[model samples]
Target: MRRPVESAQYTSGQYARFARDHGVRLSVGRKGQCWDNAVAESFFATIKTELLDRQSWPTKALAHKAIFEYVEGWYNTRRRHSSLGYLSPAAYEATQETATERAVA
Candidate 1:
């Protein structure tokens, strides 16, 4: 976890490089602002609320597996998202595919 101050001080290139090194992407907002990451913050909040807050795991491994299931199997595959017209992410992706096929046809 990065401290807010440390994260704020990192240049875009440095951050991007660090992300690349870690095999993760960093969507850093513009400098001198915290509100730019509202969407990500909201997602984390949802994850905590719906998944983490609802259960207690006895071990780190169990917690990891539970979070993985929540994110991959439930949230991405089945949860309705208001931002996507109340469709799950998988459903939204399917709709996008249909739209692309219709456009091609």
Candidate 2:
């Protein structure tokens, strides 16, 4: 017997096939699970608050450039995060790398 495919299921299946074919890993989360992407959600909120809310961008390219600089130059390198005990992402990564090296030695 042939079962009917719902539109949402069919769309998701097609996307999953596309992702698999392209070697892209898609994040899986339950329909109502908020915490599954809590980190990403928090990051988005922070970026919106720290960058996007402060100014108006005339073009997408300008916005993209600004966001790139903010993330690479400011956020990762200089901004202190509360979750990481006030260490910048670069500093936290350095500490983590050091710990890994110590563990391997």
Candidate 3:
């Protein structure tokens, strides 16, 4: 049996049609479950504190470009993550790749 949609945002005809066309599931966490979305909230809070709160953009396009650059150039590449033993994401991924290759050899 198909599950009932819990949120109106996902229940609208337009969203249903879009999801069907894209072969996507409109899934969300249970209502009042803050833990399910904690990672996303933390990421947004970091962005707000580091970028959004620091600058004023005159255009939406500029803001979009700035956010893209910030994520790609700094956050994903150079910024150290304590969760990854203080290595940047790119460095952590490289280390993982090297380990995998060594194990396979």
Best by lDDT: 2
Q: For every model shown, what is its TM-score relative to the native structure?
A: 0.67, 0.75, 0.66
Clash count, predicted structure 2 = 0
* C-alpha local distance difference test of each model: 0.83, 0.86, 0.84
Worst 10 contiguous positions by lDDT, candidate 2: 3-12
lDDT of 2: 0.86
| Local accuracy of candidate 2 as per-residue lDDT tens digits, 46-70 | 9999999899999999999999999
**Model 3 regions more than 4 Å off:** 1-21, 25-36
Q: Which ranges in model 1 have alpha carbons more than 4 Å from their true place? A: 1-7, 10-13, 16-26, 32-36
Q: What ranking of all candidate models by TM-score puts the best one first? A: 2, 1, 3
Residues forming the 10-long window of minimal summed lDDT in candidate 3: 26-35
Q: For model 3, which pairs clash?
A: none
Comparing 2 with 3 on TM-score, the higher-scoring candidate is 2
Q: Is candidate 1 or candidate 2 better by TM-score?
A: 2
